[model samples]
Target: MDVACAFPTTLDTPDNIAMAESLGYVRAWVYDTPQQSPDVWMTLALAAQRTERIGLGPGVLVPSLRHPMTNAAATATLAALAPGRVSVAFGTGFSGRRAMGYGAISWSFMDAYITAYRGLLRGETVEWEGKRMRMLHPAGHAPARPVDVPVLVGALGPMGNEVARKHADGLYVTFQPPEFMREYSWVPYLAWGTVLGEGETPDSEHARLAGGPGWALAYHGAYEFGGPAAVLDLPGGEQWLAVVERSPAEERHLAVHSGHCVELNEADQAAWDAGGHSILTDVTISGTRDQVRRKLDDLAAHGVTEIVFQPCGPDTRTELERFLDAAGSHLKPA
Candidate 1:
């Protein structure tokens, strides 16, 4: 399996991308939550300038946040800067939109958006807002026609998976077990929070704290999809539901931003802690080095082609280095 690092698009993102490249990570995925981090495309442009071998792109850009034309142009520009080292993943808005007090875009919108975006990237004119448009750039200034960029779709449900299979090169799923992917056929790119410390097992407190935010994200996703009732079946789901129940209806959507591993505030951290530590063991790959290696092997054997590791905690660089030390041998050449 190939390893990728997902960053929060902070000021240090380019630095981290360069470090990850040197450490043998295959890709660097920048998050697109504009309210929380720097501009994702600008960060990616810096990453492209800093790193030579690693792939760089938005882990999943929200289609609703920008016009398909804008996304196509920005991606084409990045592809020009990085040449063959660019790939993009699109998704219905999550933190990027919800943080702005909106819900995810409809699947139909995403399907149409991907179609048009792909067409525009290939230097073909695509109909947009009742008019046809194409990226206009001089031959030497932009990537040549038929830009070879792989587009993936970030999805969590059956409808999203279907859209990805139909319109995208692959599927980017979060917190899904390998067995789930084996049952549903698609090129799988799995994203999980990874926490590795000396002598710490998957159930350790340190591990739980490191991986808890990812579980919290799953809880939030479940609630968004099916209301509080949908998440009741998950471990510690009742607690998350209770928290949501206590919030006023007007403020509930903000809960979607509660469990981000990269920007957990005190309140969010407390809420995640209340969800119980074992929730981390269920949703994340957290353990000692040998245990993490075993988990990586299991994921690869079950059909995961890429693992995008979201390293959490205050010292991200340390966490990333430890994660690479444990699993870097499994990284396939880009």
Candidate 2:
């Protein structure tokens, strides 16, 4: 099975990225969170110079947060520096307007961003704000290792996935099963599977990890195409947002943290299975290596091309050591 380790969205450090490479991770994925974390592109650029072969990119950059022109420039620069190692995943970001101080845009905006971004990558000159611009350094201009930079769309629902299929080179999903992915044609569907650390208790590691920044996934389902307002149409959506908005920080975090485990329940499993989602749907690869190997094996059986492991909490080095030790036998050679 192919595996990669995630950089904590808010608490990422160079030491953690370095450790992941030493532990045999093929790709070191980072996140693009505006409110509390360092900028994803700059961090990845620094990380690019620090590591040799590991892949790097924002697990997601909210399309709504910046113009596609800016994204195009930044990604192009990274591709130039890192060559074939950069993969850009664009998506809708959600937390709360309070945290980021901005409202969400519509799905139509997402379509425009992808179309424009891809066009630029192919050396097509696109018109923006009454001006025509193309990639400054076209793909064929330099022999600096032909760029294999893939633009991954952070898809959460069928609609988003379908749209992604029409434009993106690959699809990056969070907390969704392989069965659902089977319906799509995107070749590489990378799932954000979190491998909870081992501790004295079954959920101790998970709890500590949950309280950290990546906790947004627990309350909110995957990446928000927009803010809470973006998916108000989803089932139990408005009520869920209401809870997130009104509850105190601690209370809201507890609610968000618990949502992830709900996906593991029998009813949820039956619903997901009935919907044709493969058994590799649960994104958390917690517990011992023996246990995680079962999940990894199941994903391979279901045709998962890559499993992106999002590590959380403070001690990334310790967690990474445990993960590599347990799953080392299953990994492909570096």
Candidate 3:
């Protein structure tokens, strides 16, 4: 399996991506949480300039955040910088929309948006909002049309997988690689958690910092999909619900999704303290070097072509380095 590193759109993205390139990572993907991090395309552009071979793009672009014309331009601009190294993926919003008190978009909307977006990239006029639109960049204005980069869809259910099969070149998934997705030759899996050090336990300070944000996502996800009662069953779910309940009903989402995928906020810390550490060690990729390697092998066996790791917390570089070392053998494909 190919190994890649993803970033949380931190200021250190360019440098971290450079580090990944040097360490033999095949690609560097940055998240698209506008409210939390820098502009995903801008951060990716900077990263592109800093590295030569590693691929760069948003891990998963939330379509609701921008007009297709805007994304087409941004994708074209990055294609100009990185050429064949550019790959873009679209997904129903999670952190990007939830943090803004919005909800995920529908597959139908995404299909239409992508149709117009790709039409523009292919130098064809497409209709949007009942008007004709095309990438009108003149000579030296942008990469000559037909940007022709790979398109992927991040999915969690059959609807998304079906849409991907129809519209995207590949699939991007987080958990449970479905049998239907096996027909696609390539699939990318985004992994969470830290590689535990020798003799270190799951509750170690470093593990918590590096992987707690992902663990806390459980609370956000459970509550978002199901309700307070749904979240009350996870490790520390009861306390986490209590913490979220502290906020006013109208804007409680602000509290629930505060530290999403980047850091652990006060509510998350409360959950962590109330026995949520198990969630980290249990569901995330936190394990010894050997154990992490086995996990990658299992994912590869299940048809995951690429394993993308996003390092979180304070010392992200160190976290990346540790994961790199832990994924020693799996870094290269068979």
The candidate that achieves the highest TM-score relative to the unseen native structure: 3
Best to worst by lDDT, what's the order? 3, 1, 2
What are the TM-scores, per candidate, against the unseen true structure?
0.87, 0.72, 0.97
lDDT of 1: 0.75
Computed on alpha carbons, the lDDT of every model, listed in order, comes to 0.75, 0.58, 0.86
Ten-residue segment with the worst summed lDDT in candidate 2?
261-270
Candidate 1 colliding pairs: none
Write candidate 1's Cα lDDT for 91-203 as tens digits: 78777888767878999888889989999878899887789888787787677777778888877777887787787777776655434455444444645566556656545
Question: Where does candidate 2 stray beyond 4 Å?
Answer: 10-12, 95-105, 129-131, 136-148, 178-180, 183-199, 203-216, 222-283
- The alpha-carbon lDDT assigned to residue 168 of candidate 2 equals 76
Off by over 4 Å in 3: none
Clashing pairs in 3: none
lDDT of 3 by residue, 125-220 (tens): 999989998899998889998889999999778888778988888888875567766777778888888888789877789878888887777788
lDDT of 2 by residue, 25-54 (tens): 878777666555678778887787777788
